[model samples]
Target: MIRAELPPYEGDTAHLRKMFSYFPSGVVALLANVGGTPKGMVASSFTVGVSMEPPLVSCAIRRQSSTWPELKGAHRIGISVFGEDQGEMARQISSKSIASRFEKIPLRHADSSALFIAQAPVWFECSFADELPAGDHTIALLEVHRGGADPELPPLVFYGSTFRQLQVSSADG
Candidate 1:
């Protein structure tokens, strides 16, 4: 067996982030309307089906996120799981310019003010349930009120700091 020596762990942020990027994850947009204005942010650290009985999902949000503070007080939040072709939409929503995030982007609004991205693969209307402090971020639990999925649209994947598409395999292995 060939074994190679690796460097000792130093807890470096950059190194840790680079290593973490190797794992692929689905991206989602968290959107809401606060005070007649739509607020949205992209998150790759999103998990669905956290609880079956209560219908819950979770997302880890950075502590420094400006958009979170505004959306936190909203009546409802929209979780839009990006479709494979919606990578550019994710980039635009996560851009630094808050004012232009939704510019030229098609959206759907609920009576509860939950704003969803049009044609997204999955959509969830959630209300903030609880939040706990995690190192450098907050772990938020959201109670799903309503949700829908489109099986035809493949999900967008984030891997190695880039957007990726899934390739379906043959039925016979």
Candidate 2:
């Protein structure tokens, strides 16, 4: 075995982020209705099917997020997995202006105050289960109360810091 000469890793934030961006992940809208206003944020760190028996999912949220403080107290939170055509929606919700995050965006609200984006490929109404401190972020574990998926709508992908769509191929080559 031969080892290739490479630069030593000094734990640079920029380089670490760039390396992390190589892995593709689906984007999701974590939202809820708080005080009659819709509060939401975009998260690519969402993981589904974490546990089956209790129906759990998780998302790593930045501790500095202004939205999380408002959302954590909500009775329920909505997780909407964006469809391929919803790239612009993700950007809108990710903006710094919290007041206008849901501007011009269609939504469906649950009785529990969970807000789901219209036309999302997948949706989950989750209750806050637990959270663990993870450096600059908190890993939030959510228990899914109810959820649904639309097979016709493919999920939006985030890779290399850009939005992408999935290309389906047959199993047989």
Q: For model 2, where is the 10-residue window of minimal lDDT?
A: 164-173
CA lDDT for candidate 1: 0.93
- Residues 112-162 of candidate 1: C-alpha lDDT, one tens digit per residue: 979999999999999999999999999999999999999989999999999
Tens digits of per-residue lDDT for model 2, 1-173:
99899888898989989989989999999999999989999999999889998999999999998889888889999999999999999999999977787889999988898999999999999989999999999999999999999998999999998999988888732
Candidates' C-alpha lDDT = 0.93, 0.93
lDDT of 2: 0.93
Candidate 1 error regions (>4 Å): 1-8
**Model 1 clash pairs?**
none
* Model 1 TM-score, 2 decimals: 0.93
- Which TM-score value belongs to model 2? 0.93
